[model samples]
Target: MRMRTKAVLLIVFLSCLAGCGSREPSAQSPQAASSSHADSGEIVLEADSLKLGQIRTAPVVVQAAPWDEFETPGRVELDPNRVSHVLMPVPGRIRQVLVRLGDAVQEGQPLLIIESPEVSAAVAAYRQAQAELRRAQSALSKAERDLSRIRDLFANRAAAQRDVWAAENEVAQAQAAVEQAKAEQEQARHRLELLGISPNEPVQQISVPAPTSGKVLEIAVAAGEFRTDTSTSLMTIADLSHVWITANVPENLIRLVQIGENVEVELAAYPGEVLRGTVRRIADTLDAETRTVKVQTELPNPSGRLRPGMFGRIRHSHGLKPVAAVPPAALVQDNEGAFVYLEKGRGRFQRRRVRAGQPRNGWAPITEGLSPGERVVVDGAILLSGK
Candidate 1:
């Protein structure tokens, strides 16, 4: 009876154990199974036992591109058209310099006086021409009166025809002398003009005058400075109503820079200030040494605040168009090339190649290899790339 009772108890315990196992999974095991299922769709696993393969992913929208415009160091330049160098035309000693450095001058205003033999000779020639003109006029008048009297006498038969003809000839000679005197006067006037002396004035010395209305930028000549035809410089003047900012752009971006394109310029001397400009010229050839093309832009300096030789930075857009752009942080470069990853799903990404374009205000242009409105892994690309 004791053995049968013990065998019944053992069978009951076995039955209970089987029933429990068939009813449900344990709490911990079900939780782990659910987690695995959740990770299945876009699973990035580092399990040593699991193997995975690469897959084609949806296209990614990149905010960064390789199409950024190239930049080169540049400086402000004096506009060639607005600059004039005041130099003495003939060899002379600078008797006096009338203007100082930075003095504003008007066109044709005399800045200095130079005493030279050439100027004195021009003045003397002009005076001699004037005296000769007076003498020729007196002679011509006397000859005309004599010819008129002889013609009257011939008409009345009191003078011979040959005598009257001879008087007419003398009158013609005097008239010719008058014309010659007038010609000489004009020649002398031009000579004085070349020496910077006015024809109507008695200027004993040559005057160095300003060619244009502008401020004197440099003064190399002082009182009593000896100047010659080959003198390096006397003074340099510049019209600062406008200036030029020349920038060198890479050869690849030369096409983007066109005349009339707007640009923003910033000077190092004037921080936090931006000047406006427009493209004026684009170089036809690239510089061999730098492999860049020069572009010139004009900036208005109505206030005369901008100066030459100032360092400047230029900014402009290539105009907006459809381009592939991804966040700047999303771009990854390596030995292979530039690439970005697209997020097909949670924790999933696929690498892709792209060509970039110009970047403005932190947004870059994608020249190719991307479309608009595609989701890309920007913040977590590095982490997702591991998967």
Candidate 2:
């Protein structure tokens, strides 16, 4: 029985030894050790492996580009300089509206018609002036003939000298009256012209023409409505082919905005499309309540896709500044934030955390944690990231 117990003890001891041996870790090969490090986010690729992975490296360049920029909320607005306010030239009742709001118009195009008694009175005065001028001309012609006949009679001693002098005086008076009548006629004609009434045609309604070529933005008059306020606007027209993006920049950053500098514009309506513009104007004064300065950027819209009141984000680039930059594709984001792969040594790369600034033209400016002349993994960064 003792011998049997010894055999069982021996078997137990062997079982324990086997269990401990199985629990011990196996020695890792060099490839396995390298792969373990790579799996922990420390990628050490050999030159051949990098070639097979199609990895590309580029030196972090010191670039002088638009690195100093600030984004401000803005909105598209009609360029006030290009806007036109169509006002009533005279008090009249609206007889017809030739165009509607938002209708494109050319200069001198008839926009509306108004029936005004003032227009009719102007035409009547012009006609009366014409009649008076004709009458004066006839009188002057008669006086000249009389004066000639009197002079001939005096030379033949058939008329007195006093009568000849009186006839001369009468001729001069007639000439003066003709001059006066001509002046009145011209004055009347100008009045008719100012009223937009043709002197040759009978005046019925005054046709109001557009003073400028633009799109009608507002119409305050309707057909049959009497607009007696000559100072009030009848319509508002705006040239929308070009627009202004008005941004209220903070007072502190107002000095950064320089007129004539190029700016980038992005509208909420069209995502991923960038519109280029130039800083055209800046307000001389700041808003007292908001403590902000108004900056205006002129944006051309040949396609007329941009409309007034559209919200936009304006990025004003003051000027170019030297900064460390890398290809935009090198940036990778994860829970740790934006980062790039640095080529630490030959056939080796390490992940680096970076604070990226605004990107321009497929290049990203590294605001922090990067320096010029360092080589970074531009292509195949994703391969390292995935591992």
**Which candidate wins on TM-score?**
1
User: TM-score for all predictions?
Assistant: 0.67, 0.65
lDDT of 2 at 203: 70
Q: Give candidate 2 regions above 4 Å deviation.
A: 1-64, 67-71, 136-180, 256-258, 316-322, 326-356, 373-387
Compose the digit string of candidate 2's lDDT tens values, residues 127-168: 899999999999999999999999999999999999999999
Clashes of each: 14, 0
lDDT of 1 at 319: 44
Evaluated at residue 17, the lDDT of candidate 1 is 96
Q: Which residues of candidate 1, in runs, are more than 4 Å off?
A: 1-74, 98-104, 108-110, 117-120, 187-207, 230-232, 248-294, 312-319, 327-338, 349-351, 377-387
Which ten residues in a row are the worst by lDDT in model 1?
49-58
What local lDDT does model 1 show for residue 57?
A: 34
